[model samples]
Target: MQRYFVQESHWQENKVTITEEDAHHIKKVMRMTEGDSLIAVHPEGKAYKVSIESVGESIICVVREEITDNKELPQQVTVVQAIGKADKVEWVIQKATELGVSRIIPFQATRSVAKWDHKKQDKKVARFEKIAKEAAEQSERVKVPHVHRVLSLQEVIEETKDYDFRVFAYENEVRNGANRKLSEHIKEMTPGTEVCVIIGPEGGFSPEEADELYQSGFTSVRLGKRILRMETAPLYFLSALSYEWEE
Candidate 1:
C-alpha cells in the first residue's frame, strides 16, 4: 500500500483528508479512487490503513485499521556528516534514513570541499528533508528523521552537547590501530539513549578540529580495519548499530 505523512488538521474523526502534493500523487500519479487502500502516517508516527472515501479536489480517506508495526531503532543515532561534493549528501540522507537514523546534521568542516551559500542553505536543508521523508515512507519507518540546517564544526559540537553520547568516526584512529571499535563505544550506550556520530568529509578533519572535538567530550572511535569513503562511513556505523541493537 502507498504511504503518506499527513498533518493533524488533515485527520479528524477517523478520516484523513489528503491535500497538496500527496493529493496530486494520489489523483494523478497513483490514480487511486474510492475504496482504494493506503497507509497514512500521523504526525506523531502512528500509521493507519485508510480506505479512500472520496476523490476530487482532495482525497479523503477513512481509517480502516491502525498499524502496530514498529520500524524505528531502539536507540536514536544522529549522524553529524561533513558536507561533501555533488549529491553525496543526498545519497547519505536517503540511505541513512533506510538504516533508521534519527537525525542528520550536515557539518561544514575545516577540510570540507563543498560549501553551501548562506542564501541557499534553506533550500539545501529543505531538499535533504524531502529526501528523508520519501526515504522514510519507502523504508516503512514510523518516524522521519530530521535534517538540520548545515552547521559549522564548532556549532555542531555545541549543538550536540546535550546528547547522551557523542563519537567521531576518525580515520586516524583506524590508522593508529585503536583497539576501540565504534561497536564498543555503542555497547556502553543503553537502549533509548541518543548518540551523535560525526563523520568527516572526503579530505577528513584537520588535526586541530579533531583535538577540539575530543576536548568537547566526543569520543574518537574507529569504524573497522579499512577506511571507508566520506559517504560510506556513516552507513557502516549505522549498519553496525542495527546489527548490535535490532532483534
Candidate 2:
C-alpha cells in the first residue's frame, strides 16, 4: 500500500483528503482507483489503512483500520549535520529518514563551504523537507522526520539543552586511538531518550568548534577506525542505532 503523510486539516473524522501531487500520483502514476487501499498517516503520528472512496479534484480515502505497527526508533535521534554540497545533504536526509532519524538539523561549521542564503533559507529547507517526506513514505514510516533551519555552532550548542544524550563525530578520536565506540554509548541510553549527534562538513570541524562541542557536553565518538564522509557519518550512526535498538 502507498503511504502518505497527510496534513491534520486534510483528515476529518475517519476520512482523509489527499490533494495536488499525491492526487496526481494516485490518479495517474499509480493508476489507483476508488477501491485501492493506502496508508494515511496523521500529523500526530497515527496511521490508518484507508481505501479510496472518491477520486477527482481531491482523493478521498475512508478509514479501514488503524495500523498499529510502529516503525519509529524507541529513542529520538536528531542529527546536527554541517552544511556540505546540496546533493550530499539531500542524500543524508533521505537515507537518515529511512534509518529512523527523528529530526535533522543543518549546522554551519567553521569549515563549511556551502553556505545558505538567508533569503532562500525557507525555500531550501522546504526542499529538504520534501525529500524527508518522500523518504518517510517510501520507508513506511508513521512520522516524518523534521528538518530544522541552518544553525551555527553556537546556536547548536545552546539548543543542546533539550537533548538527553549528545555526541559528535570526531576523526581525532580514531587518530588518537581513543577507544570511543558508539555501541558503548548506546548501552547508556534508555528508551524514549532524545539524542543529538553532530556531523562535520567535508573539511571537518575546526579544533575550536570541536572544543566548544566537547565543553557543551557533547561526547566525542568515532564511527569506526576509519573516518567517514560528511554525509556517510550520520547514516552509519543511525544504522548502528537501529541495529542496537531494533534488531
Candidate 3:
C-alpha cells in the first residue's frame, strides 16, 4: 500500500484532507480512487490505515485503524557530513534516511570544497528535506529524518558536545591500520543514546580538524580497510550500525 504524510491541520475528526502535491499524486499520478486503502503518516509519526472516502480536487481519507508499528533505529544517529561537490549531498541524504539515520548535519570542514552560498542555503536544505521525506516514506520509516542547517566545523563541534557517542571517519586512520572500529563504540551504547559520526568531503578533513574532533571526545575510527567516498562512508557506517543494533 502507498503511504502519504499529512499535516495536523489536515486532520478533522476521523478523516484527513490531502491537498496540493499529495492530492495531485493520488488523483493524477497513482490514479487511486475512493475505497482504496493506504497508510497515512501523521505529523507526530503515527500511521493509520485510511480508506479513500472521496477524491476530486482533494483526497479525503477516513481513518480505518491505527498502526502501532515503527521502523526506526533504537539509537538516534546523526551523520555530520561535509558538503561535497555536485549532487553527492543529495545522494547521501536519500540513502542515509533509508538506512535509518535520525538526523543529518552538513558541516563545512576545513578542506571542504563545495561551499553553499548563504543566499541559497534555505533552498538547498528544503530540497534535501523533500528527498528525505520521500525516502523515509518509501522505506516505511515512521518519522522523516531532518536535514539540519549547514554549520562550520567549530559550530558542529560545539553542538555535538551533548551527544552520548561521537566518532569521525578519518581516512588516515585506515592508512595507519587502526584496529578500532565503530562497532566497538556502538556496542557500548544503551538504547536512546545519541550517536554522531563525521565524514569529510572530497578532499577529506585536515589534520588539525581531526585533532580538534578527537580532543573533543570523538573517536577516530576507520569504516574499513578500503577508502570509501565522502558519500559512501556514512552509508557504510549506518549499515554497520543497523547490523549490530537491529534485532
Candidate 4:
C-alpha cells in the first residue's frame, strides 16, 4: 500500500484529513478518486487503511482499519556523517535508512568538501530531509531517520557526548594489516543502547580532529584495511549493527 505520513491532528475518530502536499499528490498527480485505497501514517504511530471519501483543497477520508508498526529496532543508531557533495550525501541518507538507522547528522569534517553559507545551508537541509522521507517510505521504515542540520566537527563532537556509545570510522588507524571488521565490535553492544557513528568526508578525518573526538569519548574503529568511500561507510556500519542488533 502507498504510505503517507500525516499529523496526529489530521486523524480523529476513524476519520483522516490529508492536507497540503498529500492532498495535491492524491488529487492532481496520482489522480486518485473517490473510494481509492491508501495507507496513512499518523504522527502518533498509527497506520490507517483509508478510503478517499472527499477531496478539495485538502483530502478527507474514513479509516477502514488501523495497523500497528512493530518492526523498529530496539537500539537507535545515529550516524553523524561528514558533509559531502549532493549525490554522495543522498546515497548515504537512502541506504542508511534502508539499513534501519535511527537518525542522521550531516556535519562538517576537517576534510569536508561541501561549502555552505546560512542561506544555502537551509536549502540543502530541506532537500536532504525530503530525501530521508522518501527513503523511509520506500524502505517501509516505521520512522523516518531525521536529517539533522549540518554542524561543524567540534560542534558535532560536543553534541554527541551524551550518547551511550560513540564510534568513529578511521581508515588510517587499523592495526598491523589486520582487517578491522565491524562484527568484532558488534558482539559487545547491548540492546536499547543509543549508538552514534561518525563517518568523515573525503580524504577522511584529520589526525588532530580524530584526537579531539577520542578525547570526547568516541572510540575510533577501523572498518577495514581498504578504506570505503565516505558515502559507503555509514551503510556498512548500519548494516552490521542491524545484523547484530536483530540477530
The C-alpha stretches of model 1 lying farther than 4 A from their native spots are none
**In candidate 2, where is summed lDDT lowest over 10 consecutive residues?**
173-182
| Pairs in clash, predicted candidate 1 | none
- lDDT-wise, the better of 2 and 4 is 2
TM-score of each: 0.97, 0.98, 0.97, 0.91
lDDT of predicted model 4:
0.81
**Candidate closer to the true structure by TM-score (higher is better), 1 or 3:** 1
lDDT of 1: 0.91
Residues 1-247 of candidate 3 have per-residue lDDT tens digits of 7888888999998999999998999888889999999899998989999999999899999999999987888889999999987499999999999999999999888888887897999999999999999998899888899899999888998988999988889999889998877678778876799999999988888989988988888888888899999999999988988888886
Please provide, for model 2 over 123-221, each residue's C-alpha lDDT reduced to its tens digit, 9 standing for 90 to 100: 999999999999999999999999999998899888877789999999899888887577999887777999999999888889999888888888999
Give the clashing pairs for model 3: none
Give the Cα-based TM-score of candidate 2 against the true structure: 0.98
Arranged by TM-score with the best first, the candidates are 2, 1, 3, 4
Taking the tens digit of each residue's C-alpha lDDT, what string does model 4 give over 9-36? 7778878899988789888888998899
Give the range of the ten consecutive residues with the poorest summed lDDT in model 4.
Answer: 172-181
Report residue 67 deviation for candidate 3 (angstroms).
1.5
> Which residue pairs show backbone clashes in model 2?
none
- Model 4 clashing-pair count: 0
Clashes of each: 0, 0, 0, 0
Off by over 4 Å in 4: 175-180
